[model samples]
Target: MTELPRDRVRELLDAVLDDEASDRDDMARRVYISPFHFSRQFRLGTYESPVALRRRVILERAAWRLRRGDSVTDVALSEGYESVEGFSRAFSRAFGFPPSAAERTSTHWLPAPNGIHFHPPTSLWVDSAEAPRSSMDPTTQMVHHDIDDTRYLLELAGKVAVRDYDRPLLPRHVVLGWDGPEESIAAVLEHLIWSKEVWLASIDGADVPARGGRDIGALAARHETAAPRFISAVQRIAAEDRWGDVLIDALCDPPESFVLGSVISHVLTFSAYRRQVVRQMLRNVGVEADQGDPIMWLRTRHQPSHER
Candidate 1:
């Protein structure tokens, strides 16, 4: 099979998440490839057909919604299934449990293929290969680690009470960069996401979107979208041996240029600091936030069976 470009594959994956690539022809058109070639390349890269991948993603999302207390009928319709019975059957077959059992059981419903994995609340990620430590490059590993840590932090944020999420955590005059005295836990989280967006746009040579006004749930969704894109962008840069290259920020009046490595380091450092602030804010509001330590999260996620 011919190799498919990773960036194009990322575009197709995003289209899948947006429910805009259901048709093979449409996906091929989006990538400027023929349908046959697109299918061949997709299967070669992901080990699943586009249709199968979409179905699995939708089902995974349905399972997540069910666990989150969405009614079965609503999930069914939202996923485009004709009826609850059909959705239940598909859900049962994919997860080995009927939709009714989702709320009561915490389980990984299906094994993701080699390259692709499901991230909760409706996201699919194309991860690095599962190779021995010596085989993977340092940059790729670091990117994966950051992505995992961010996901863990989002999970912790999900536990914050809605009332506490937007409550002021600092006086209005005390500002952190763009955040001001009206800063709440939500504002801090939003800034964290906004920073990521701006850095990613710089990397991609795209314009940054306007920031703020997103709730906690919307921020989580943005993280889900941004994390994978950032990973793919970093990996592409690493593949091209361009981490040391300078990216000029035309949006800046002085037109500042930053070394790609410095930009990445800044993002990682700022994300850690902001996450800690959010955790502290959650604690002050009586929510039992996790320690938000990446090492602990890694250990729990990849622990040996003997240790367990």
Candidate 2:
């Protein structure tokens, strides 16, 4: 079978995520592909049929809602199941537990075959396991790899020429999908640091330090202080295996709740994307920034010079 383009698959997956009520036919129509071809391509690319993927995603959403205290009947109806019994049967098959049991125990559900996972009410992303593990066990060392690269990127950003530090390399609307008062390189770096603090505050319920202004030095220093806190938090979470604890985020107007593991995944995803943005911006301004590829970082950090 011919391999489908990854970008096209991502588009289709995003469409499915946007509307779980949409059937495979609707999805094919939206993407302007025939249902037969779309189904074949989707299955080949994602290791699951389009319909199966959508159902699994919807069921995962249902599990998250159930954990967040939503009634099983309401979640069932919202997810398009006609009755509680039907929803319960499907939920049990997908997650190995009924909706009520999931709500009571509040355990972590397995990720989708495609590696796309959700954190409830909001937040979804394709898992990119590009970073190398510091140890054989992923659960223990993934966060350390993230922390190391985060600090490295911040140090590289600090070396950008002073005049170009605050220059607008990419518009805020393009980078963040919305307009903001500040759209400079420095603003992106500050936002990167500030985002971690936000997640840290949500995880620990402690007062975080104020965001460093446009000064890259100050931002680096603030990040140096904040990065360890996040490392500690992740270590603690990993040690206790509390990846499924529900966290109520006070930052949202209605207050959003997400599984703790999802929040950590969100942090890793956000950091990876923004760090590359900063690296590219630095390169644009004539700084000889490393490519900032996580794998390359790992190779340089681990293997000796004469290994090859």
Candidate 3:
């Protein structure tokens, strides 16, 4: 499966903030996705339109500066808003008041590591989580781990893949290459989003299609390609606004030679490594990860969950 166009995602963000790539048609073409499809997918994946997401990102950065007492005009320019009025309108829309109001207030609202917070008083509003940026509160580590569990449905797709096909074939396990360690594929994918569900928990991400996927079985009976199925899982994650954005951000401007196999290996290794880290990080706090199906360590050294 292929990921979405990273440059297009960047362009949409920049367009929203700076009009750097203001051509709507170009925006649509860059993702190789239609504007409507693109907009819908962007909203589903990011919980905001390309434009709105960009604005929020801008506001977040601007808010950081505002908290430091950067002037409205300066904040606007920093955010790439053409004029102060333009920046104010967008900022007001995001925060429910103008920058002037923000300046007047002693406390401002925003998310902190484990919770939401307001300045001046520093009141806490939420609990700490694994993926705070995505607002996901999970006990499992965001780092990668070996996984042996497979969705019964995904296995069904794999069975269909070997047969005669007029359609596509999906796999229960997201297979990238027989050449590399299976761990690598899982790791690379996890590094993209840092979601703990798939690699660290018994639960899988919402992006995993339901037991009965989008009529994918029929495709499995057809041309018989697993790539389509894997792509669907990634896109489902992307469209659902999950921590997939973390993955998206990681790839938005990735290094030129992102060795797919080696990276996946690292990602999977991290899961086991992180569980060790989590054990240490939480031991003092009394939040321990009981060894079980998801977290199967062999001896003092880490082992792949597949063997468990």
Model 2 per-residue lDDT tens digits across residues 259-303: 999988877776667777777777787776767665664564454
Give the per-residue lDDT of model 1 (tens digit) for 69-126.
9999999998899999999998986776889889997753444443466677556655
Per-candidate TM-scores read 0.56, 0.51, 0.30
Query: For this target, which candidate reaches the highest TM-score against the unseen true structure?
Result: 1
lDDT of 1: 0.67
Q: What's the lDDT for all of these models?
A: 0.67, 0.66, 0.38
Indicate the worst ten consecutive residues by lDDT in candidate 1: 127-136
Candidate 2's C-alpha runs over 4 A off are 1-134, 139-142, 174-182, 304-308
What is candidate 2's local distance difference test score? 0.66
Displacement of residue 181 (Cα, Å) in model 2 is 6.5
- What clash count goes with each model? 1, 0, 20
Winner on lDDT (1 vs 2): 1
Ranking of all candidate structures by their lDDT, best first: 1, 2, 3
Model 3, span 135-238: residue lDDT tens: 22222222111321112122222333223211211223233342222222222222222322222211222343212122333322211122212322333443
